[model samples]
Target: MRRLLGRDHDNRGFGSLQRGTEDAAKGQGDASETKGQSPIRHHGGKEINREQIHQQIGSLSELTITFLLDKPRILTDIQTEYRNVYSLSYLSDREFWTCSFNDNILNLCNLQGEILRSVQTKSKNWPYGIAVTQSGDLVYTDPRDCSINLVSGTQIQTLITLWGWTPLHPCGTSSGDLLVVMESVDNKNTKIVRYSGSTEKQSIQWDEQGKPLYTSLGNTKYLSENRNLDICVTDYAAHAVVVVSAAGKLRFRYTGPPSTLLESFSPLDITSDSLGNILVSDPYNDHIHIIDQDGHFFRYIYNCGLQCPWGLCVDSRDNLFVAENVSGKVKKIQYYK
Candidate 1:
């Protein structure tokens, strides 16, 4: 296995880089996985080569974290180290899931980022963007399938079939519902809608003036709500994080100060930590920004070698899991005091 991040690694241009996401169906490991470990696993006596992971180390800068960063869990046992999980989503209190680029769903050991066990997928396309409900059910969007599906109790079922359409992305809520941000009509009509298993529920696309919220940009994605009864989302076209009250009232906005780093970032996913610190994905810039509750730039975590981090989620322990679009790999960054 290769190291995901190392000081000696320099991201040479495209010709020298390896696409980190391997074929999930064939799988790249002989590690016996349990729930909460890595998404890739051992199959019958065969092993998949995951050695290409560390060689393409992308160049990223260090962020000034306000709070201390959590210690990364190191897997000593070679058979359970989940080094290539592409998505991090919790299905229950003691169980979470990770998937590889080729849709190998596995029960994972999250705190240390390990793989527990895996159930292969029927559909072989690469899977990303996972949304697990409160009741140990999983829902996710597959770019290849052009739809969202549910995975629970070893059964995979299609819930929503979307083609030629989808907003920024979909996220799971506390009530087992999905809050989806989608791009529509030439990217001019961006909206967030709640889905009760694919059925449309409450919506939050209108502003105070009742204008439909939309952006004509290719980089529109990600939505989240704060504990303080406010909704915060990223608007890549506007180059700002849009904030509104739960009742649709405009609260405030946060944008990084002007700089080359601040330019052309397609903000994807967002989450609010227990400290009321808001972290949003700036995938285009290969970093996640931690903003204060007052919407001020605090710091950037995992700043380099990130190629369009999408599918962002934070667990109960506040570990940030980011999905890298190009690499098709999900990396976990533990946050602590």
Candidate 2:
């Protein structure tokens, strides 16, 4: 049962973000060096007007740069009825859907932890993964039936069912598609597949060298597509966060920061912020890792009273929601300014 994906930390201290500086251009130098004129910036060889200065960050054209707060604090904590909260997905800025590993019930709760609505899986089996679509509908994976189901109002519809594979994690992409991490019944093969409704669009299984990208040990891989369209997966058995380009090319793998206190890096749930920064929950260490899109270590969120942090998701405002398995509480953390 240890490898069957059902699994079961503390604390608060401030962790600072080690901000890195980036040059405007590779060798062209800063435009501000010419003291007599207003500060102008160049992006992709195009001149940026003074009015757009605040809107741009580094090479990102339209993205507004946001910095981490000196002290990331929990805004509020929402208590749930689940004995162990497993997964959660943001339905709106004020609402989210969550489910426990042992229960078939999925609850839609507001920021105050009020259960405004609840739905049970049609199969009456616990959902291995849950995601909310752009249309504000619930999509979940039922490993017990090897099916991907969607909840549209009061109707529960089966989207897809597999014969030999069991879907574990489902993430709704920006392009209105779905990405799922699945494992063979024998647990000898693991892969991620993208689906356009019920039709399979892409499969990400092997690396450039043809080696398996994810561990076949268990169905514990949780994934999120970043703002830059990169698919980020936290492979618990691998003890690494594997990120790949939108085209399925390997980008990088982050295996925790150097000199960590935990015996092993156990990354469960993953999410990406507005800045394309990948946030992963390290429940074994009682912290969350904040890394840049390029896999650079940014900092750690350790002082936010996290214990057995499992599922993670960022709201539209970039505020983080962490599901603490042991406490049965979901903490809303404001990390960025």
Candidate 3:
């Protein structure tokens, strides 16, 4: 597959943003020069450097601006039994798996939202994440036990037990491996680890210079691997969408849109489409932001009337599924024309 953002594209605007941020982080930028300019927008009132805004605008030229006019419609809204549905994954085009944070139950439901089969978790620990493995088995994480469990045809087994780390989210990659989001015992360190069965294959934590790649505050990091194997994460605490190369190298970070409608950009769940574009849920702004693989701001899905969109997933045909947390409903939407 072609690289999501072609290497030949002029990304100098983004490069300038990266350099300016690095300089600011190292205490090298002049404070007086930034005194009056409308500080470029960013999460948490931090000075969004000019380079960052320039880069975001520069990326718009490469995007299909007309796609925004293709408004997405809610094909259907299926109500569930749970009070709050935290996570969702597709078992097939006709079926899906969902975990209830309040009821502590894992459900296998049809497109009509009818419960086909239900299983209580092995422990009182609520399942925070869920995914379907290559073998069609269901895998989930129990934060209380720090264990990753697999369920095949009603038989539940412990696949891996994390000793010092806490697994928060689990996603199945196209290569049949599993990518898990984890946190340290103190919750001050967070990372993503790739596992082949029970053996750890790779760990992504720090950058080349050894600085932590993600914020180390909470276990709200949701992850999905793109078609090109770039690991995409929605960091709730950092208020940014962080993407890294398959080798765990930091590629780019996208802080939400630079619109006045947004006060804070807190991204929750994330998924990648067939075209390699990244879709992120921004409940704080009551809309979702779609960006290119290179982290360029594209457009917003606001006409769909989404409320507190907590979970996101894309089917094989590129159909988008959104979990509305407050109303206990799931909306199937179509964005591409």
- Top candidate, metric TM-score: 2
Tell me each candidate's TM-score: 0.62, 0.83, 0.80
Q: How does candidate 1 score on lDDT?
A: 0.52
What's the residue-level lDDT of 63 in candidate 1? 24
- Write model 2 residue lDDT over 1-337, tens digit each, in one string: 0366322100010000000001111111200011011111100011235344434545332232346775688998889877567788887778888987567899999988889999999998878888877667788888877788888899888878787777888887777778889887766888888877677768999999999989986566899988778999999879899999889999999998877665577788899876677889877667788888888777788776677777888876778999877667999999876
Native-to-model Cα distance after best TM-score fit, residue 286 in candidate 3, in Å: 1.4
Candidate 1 deviant stretches above 4 angstroms: 1-87, 91-96, 99-114, 117-128, 142-146, 161-168, 185-188, 258-264, 302-311, 322-334
Per-residue alpha-carbon lDDT of model 1 for 229-283, expressed as tens digits? 4667777657778887756666777777445455465465677764456788765
Runs with alpha carbons beyond 4 Å of true place in candidate 2: 5-66
Question: Which pairs, if any, clash in model 2?
Answer: 13-303
Please report, as a residue range, the 10-residue window in candidate 2 with the lowest summed lDDT. 9-18
Query: Residue 63 in candidate 2 has what lDDT?
Result: 35
> Can you write out model 3's per-residue Cα lDDT over 68-168, one digit (the tens) per residue?
44688887788877644657887666777887544558898877989999888787556768888766778888766677888778777777777667777
